[model samples]
Target: MNDFPWLSVLIALPLVGAVAVALLPRDRETLAKQAAFGISAVVGVLAIVMATGFDSDGARFQFTETHWWIKQFGVHWALGVDGIALTLILLSVVLVPLVILASWSDAERSGGVDGAPPKGSVKTYFALILALEAAMIGVFAATDVFLFYVFFEAMLIPVYFIIGFYGGPQRSYAAVKFLLYSLFGGLLMLVSVIWLFPLSAKPVGEGGLGHGTFLFTELNTMHVDPTTAKWLFLGFFVAFAIKAPMVPVHTWLPDAAQQSPAGALVLIVGVLDKVGTYGMLRFCLELFPGAAKWATPVVLALAVVSVIYGAVLAIGQVDLKRLVAYTSVSHFGFIVLGVFAMTTAGQSGAALYMINHGFATGALFLLVGFMIVRRRSARISDFGGVQKKAPVLAGLFLIAGLAGLSMPGLSPFVSEFMVLAGTFTRHRVPAIIATFGVVLAAIYILWMYQRTMGGPVREGNESILDLTAREKWAVGPIIAVIIAMGVYPQPVLNIINPSVHHTLARLDRPDPAAKIHVAEKVAENGARP
Candidate 1:
């Protein structure tokens, strides 16, 4: 059973679904949506079944399938997943169906959304969604560097159209900016990936494998000089940072999120952005440990900046979508910070953060999307006292908002706590400063909630309806998962810890033990007196 090509099946199912969904007549918008949702749900279920078969302690990468796709370049149609990759794939599949459900009517009418007349039909909108889901799963599952890159770049297409044709007025500009930034990053990564080939092809006598290959496991054994490794690391890191949408490079995200449909934005920020941080953990740290360690200081500094800057900016946004977008920028900073902190707790926290952020932010975006559908506005001032009219909607928004802020007994809080705790164990000062981002998170999430869901029921908001049965179904699972994970995270951690330890072993680093004992001693000196 384990030998079955589960990952390929996972990828192919969604692609076939996309084609099937697309072939539906344009007039059959409802059928198109139902077909898309059903397909995504099946994919999600299949992924869950695959996860059940995974033995996290048995091997670093499982469900292995390796066949040469390009013999000349030694690239393989390899696919596998470690704990990190498996969890992320799960996050992607789980969200796709819900996104489809949440967006059922979002594209039904071209004129209803804020964009210029829609250029794509409703069937196309849902088809693009399924296509994006396929690419996302493939990227997470690919263990070959070249195959990973292929899936990485392919993900941009459906997303670009989803934004460009079915989103807000500025979607064209947003999609263009997104494409340009991504292509620039991807080109650099391609250079680095190409560079790895010759590095791997060098003679074994010269610390090389004596043959060209892009299989991740083989390349992990290849040796490159520090200078070359640093350059290669930088190439890959920049691409991921842009995707992670870290500070400076992250300018593309807010614009993209602002222009994206609520459903697409959920996938963009929730799953797509994660590819960046996951790349850092998998490729940068494991493949270029020295460069990763050397680059830690600068990366940590930038992560801290992203944390504070994103939160501060989110607090000030009048546009509801942009505000949530900025909060993601801030949330991602924590993920990056934890990754570079380079400790077991830190990296594990980083991995878990990716999943938690997906559900937390996804729910927020969907609920907000629901609000926008009724009011046809994304401005904070455009809403008030929504709780008076739609109590259930307002209540769910409050829970999701609190989760975003990392309030206690929520999954986001658990992940955030682990990140801060992990970082503190290794890098204290940056961890301290990054805590301010937490305070700012509270301010932004609460302030936005207060403005949109609080106060007297504004004249127009009085008639705003509660969540429909379908919307409740779409969001219910996420909320349950959040609470369940928040209360007990050990099950997921069991699946994540083995991969993290193996990655750390690859770096030849372990938790600094003697020094921690010494630090405790220093704190105890003369303290009893």
Candidate 2:
């Protein structure tokens, strides 16, 4: 056994930091902010250490920790990391510090004397941000079904407050809408989990829920009827899809994105939203392979609609944040398409897409925030000729915007290509239509760039300064990583492949919709029992 409980350390550090921030004296607001940042930075460092030691070649969970948590329910305090979990956890760590940093000026500005947020509010805000970090890490690290559910639900608390208390004019309404929608989704998932708990209680021969434990490992080994499994699968899918903000359930995301503080927007869209796609992979696909296969065509159709719909909507948006938010819908459609395609390259591409989307989209949101901070506006038409006034800022925006459009040398290009290639191997018609999304992406992305960054310098824009040293530090590395990933994506692919293969192997049921050369049913019926 490993001497240290590293996984626990990851969760505990931030929880403790949050508590510390919460307890700080009102007079020491700056101290409280510093404490939160210091704690988050420390956690980020520890996460990087964990990454260095992570066994990329191995598909099994690492740094695993488990102990009895609730005897009556057979729930355990289990935690671990695979490549999927690792990438998300790293994302959490990376973003928390940036979020804290992003809010520093806003927090102080809002807390000042006239029409500003009170000093006490800053401390509380930072505390909530730290708490959010802990919960996000927990969601990804959890291995037990119960523990995962706990973390999954726990995340909304910080997010709700972040939007409600710190957001724009319609903060309250937006927060409530976000809360009710997510809670509705979460409640459905809770009902599903409650039903799922018993599936593990059966014995193999008697069909007595199979393993009698809530462990994902054990549950993954048990088989459920395809008929009964699809409903359970939908329960999880709806919840995750809402979080993924796919299609109809996606109405809340743009509002939340529009109204939320810059820090919260980064985490919500960049990292938290990924949990939805992750759930589809971890729960829906792995546990209900037959159902997932059965549902692929429908899901793929919705994905195509979202891709086109989001692109079309984005083109019409005046609010920059809302435009970026809609782009995520289109981006997630590609992700979902890759996922349900169920090919090796497709799944890996999906996984890679998550990381790239986070970086690219997160950068876009951050750049927008920076612009809003300087100009006191988020309207696409508010200013132009930014390249002349703030060349570095405009340049970074171009890089991020180009990345969004999936320029060939950017990280998204590699992932998007793989997704298209993999999907074509399975669903040629849908693949062809999905290609239209790329064209749409180019249109919206380039148009947004041209509107915001091109044209003559506006009169008031003359006073605007280029990116600050601190701002450069904040966004530069994110851009660098995007470029690095684009230039050499092999390492990420290598790390992700092992886990993807293992997951696919566990999906033992044949994909009915798949164009298999041999009829699996005929072969099965012909085989000796």
Candidate 3:
């Protein structure tokens, strides 16, 4: 088992499942759906196994498998995971099966806003979803810079079709917008990728005399001029910021989320968007530490703006899906801030926040999807006194909402607190301003809940049914993880800390408190003299 190719298996399982799904008889939609779910479930189990076996104390990459793929271009099919990548891979795997179950009935429903008819085959829908899963796993697992880029761009295809074919009236427009934004960012990254190749061509230990290679380990050893490094950093950072959907570049997310189906939205928001922040930690910061430190002030300002702006916008949203999307913008701000804070606690919190946000927001989106399915409307005004008709659903919604607002006993609260605490150690004013976002979070979540679930029963909502068994199964795990993580974060934090420490070590920035302690020791020594 120790020598097994577990990471390869994790990546291959989903790709194989996708092919199997696509080959199923066109009319046998049920069988295709079942196969997709089974494959994703197995992948989820494998991820759990990987997590359980992971050595929390080790900061080095594990389960690594590297093979030269395009030797001429210095590209390799390299894959590996540290605690950071492993946790994200787990989040991606865990969400896929739940997404399949959550959208099973939605897939069967008549398509279009007017109940015209199904516009796409169920077989293709599930198959595309499975394919997307494969790309996500590949993205997290890829240790070669070029291989990561391949997976990064490859992810857009399945999601594009999912949004365009299976989405709402504005599906085409939203999908196009998403593609355009992503493609623009990708092009900039491609230029950076090409520029980095010459730097890697030199021989190992010969300053810059290694054969050109895209392996992260080799690339990390190659140094570039400071001016050149900053430009490359910007190229990668812009691409990731768009994907992270941070404030200004974030415009596409609400539109895309609004038009996409529930399951697709889960993967889009929960897993795919994470690639941005993950890239910043892995590539931008590690590959260009001088540039990262130089750009910190500007980046921190944008992060603060994202926090306040996204929360304020979320409070004004009338569409439930759109509201969830806006809240993500705000949440992502915290993750970015933590990453840029350049502290172990900050990075660890950012990583943990990514996992917790996935579950918390996933529940909110899934539940909102359920409500939309029941009422055939995404408008907040379409719901009233929903708790009277579906107490279980309302209760679940409250829990998810509370988690989003960082209520003391939920998972997000723990991570959010750590982010702020860490940020204050290095940056006091930005952290203080960012705190206002928390207040706005409460206003938006509670206000939305009160209007939709606590009011007098609307005429049509009285007959809306409670969650079905499948819905319960889908949401139950998310809720359980949320509470468990909030109460006992040590397990995940244990895994996250080593990776965070490793990253901070690479950046070589000292903690302010550590500096202060050193100064105190110097004063004591002087007094003794």
In terms of lDDT, the best-performing candidate is: 1
What is the per-residue lDDT of model 1 for residues 140-208, given as tens digits with 9 covering 90 to 100?
A: 999899999999999999999998888788888999999999999999999999999988885667554
Model 1: lDDT equals 0.89
**Which 10-residue span in candidate 3 carries the lowest summed lDDT?**
520-529
- TM of each candidate vs. truth: 0.95, 0.93, 0.95
lDDT of 3: 0.88
Full-model lDDT, candidate 2: 0.84
Off by over 4 Å in 1: 110-115, 202-209, 514-529
How far is each candidate from the true structure, as Cα RMSD in Å?
4.2, 6.3, 5.2
By the lDDT metric, which is better: model 1 or model 2? 1
lDDT of 3 by residue, 1-529 (tens): 4367888898888988888898889999889889999999999998888777778765378888888899888898888898889989999998999999999966677544446344678988998899999999999999999999999999999999988888888888999999999999999999998889987787567454656778899888778889999999999999999999897899999999988998889999999999999999999999999999999999999999999999999999999999999999999999999999897667877888999999999999999999999988889998999999999999999999999998876889878877887788899899999999999999999999998999899977878999999999998899998888877677787777788877788889967654333222221231121
Clashing pairs in 2: 110-117, 111-117, 200-212, 202-208, 202-209, 202-210, 203-208
The CA lDDT at 283 in model 3 is 95
* Runs with alpha carbons beyond 4 Å of true place in candidate 2: 1-3, 110-120, 204-211, 509-529
